[model samples]
Target: MHNQIDQAAGLRKLKKNKPVRVIAITSGKGGVGKTNLSVNLGIAMAQKGQRVALLDADMGLANVDILLGLYPKFNLSHVLTGEKKFG
Candidate 1:
């Protein structure tokens, strides 16, 4: 189990160090399809076998995970509340 964790960490490090371009989509207003674009972009990257982590930092209005229909066991709120570390 420890070996598997180490291997996964190594792979993540390799992916981060790889020469892959990153794109950030932003909008000044809500309901502007920004979330949709980000979701599709992330999906495309992952489909291409690239490592991706989509963070929704909208505070009270975050919806990236919701748009993707993913129910995370823990979110930024948990970390902000000191329930988790920035591992």
Candidate 2:
């Protein structure tokens, strides 16, 4: 199918670009350990001197900052609305 071909091409491009490894944790039920695992893993990687950026992509229900107890002046919404940059 065209979709499969496009996906294969995308994967090949990603392989050639040698981007950093990406991990995605998904689930169907709420209150699972997705956020917990992401935070702990990110912290552990940082403790090991690895650069890490943990993004909670739950657009409608993001709580990474809440769980970490940090208030961010800007968030994905701000970026999407052109009030902030993705950088």
Candidate 3:
């Protein structure tokens, strides 16, 4: 399918020998500490000199920025809307 080709092209664009790794922490219940765990884990990894990015995918009710005390001018929505690109 077209999507598969696009995915392959995207992979080909990545630097050789360097692959992307992703981790997801989720729970069925709200207010259970997913955000806290994500923040802490990201910080720990960064402290270890590893590249880390925490995405707040909660859409309308996002709170990771607040929890991290950050004010992001751009987010995934901007990227999805073609207003920005992941560099």
Candidate 4:
């Protein structure tokens, strides 16, 4: 099991040598599954041994973390408020 995990990790790292593509999906109004699609797509890419980062740019009301069932320690709001950097 450990060996398999190591191999998978190595492959994931190897895949990271290639550039990661970012795709942004936006909607003019709410109720659309933009966050859902973005989260799922990011997860799918990572599962396929690719590097992915999902950023929620909805300043007024961000929902990407909510849709992913994640309670982030900090968000873009913190960065904009000078609490964090662009990690």
lDDT of each: 0.73, 0.77, 0.77, 0.74
RMSD of each: 7.1, 6.3, 3.4, 11.3
TM-score of 2: 0.70
As for candidate 3, its clashing pairs are none
- Once all C-alphas are superposed, what RMSD does model 4 give against the true structure? 11.3
lDDT of 4 by residue, 10-62 (tens): 33664578654557798888878888888888899899988777889888888
User: What global local distance difference test value does model 3 have?
Assistant: 0.77
TM-scores, all candidates, are 0.65, 0.70, 0.77, 0.68
Q: What is the C-alpha lDDT profile of model 1 across 1-87, one tens digit per residue? A: 553323234336656777545577877887889888889989998999988878786788788888888887888777666566443
**Tens-digit lDDT string for candidate 3 (1-87):** 654323234435553557767799888999999999999999999999988868787878889999889998987777666566554
lDDT of 3 at 45: 93
Steric overlap count per candidate = 0, 0, 0, 0
Better candidate number, 2 or 4, judged by lDDT: 2
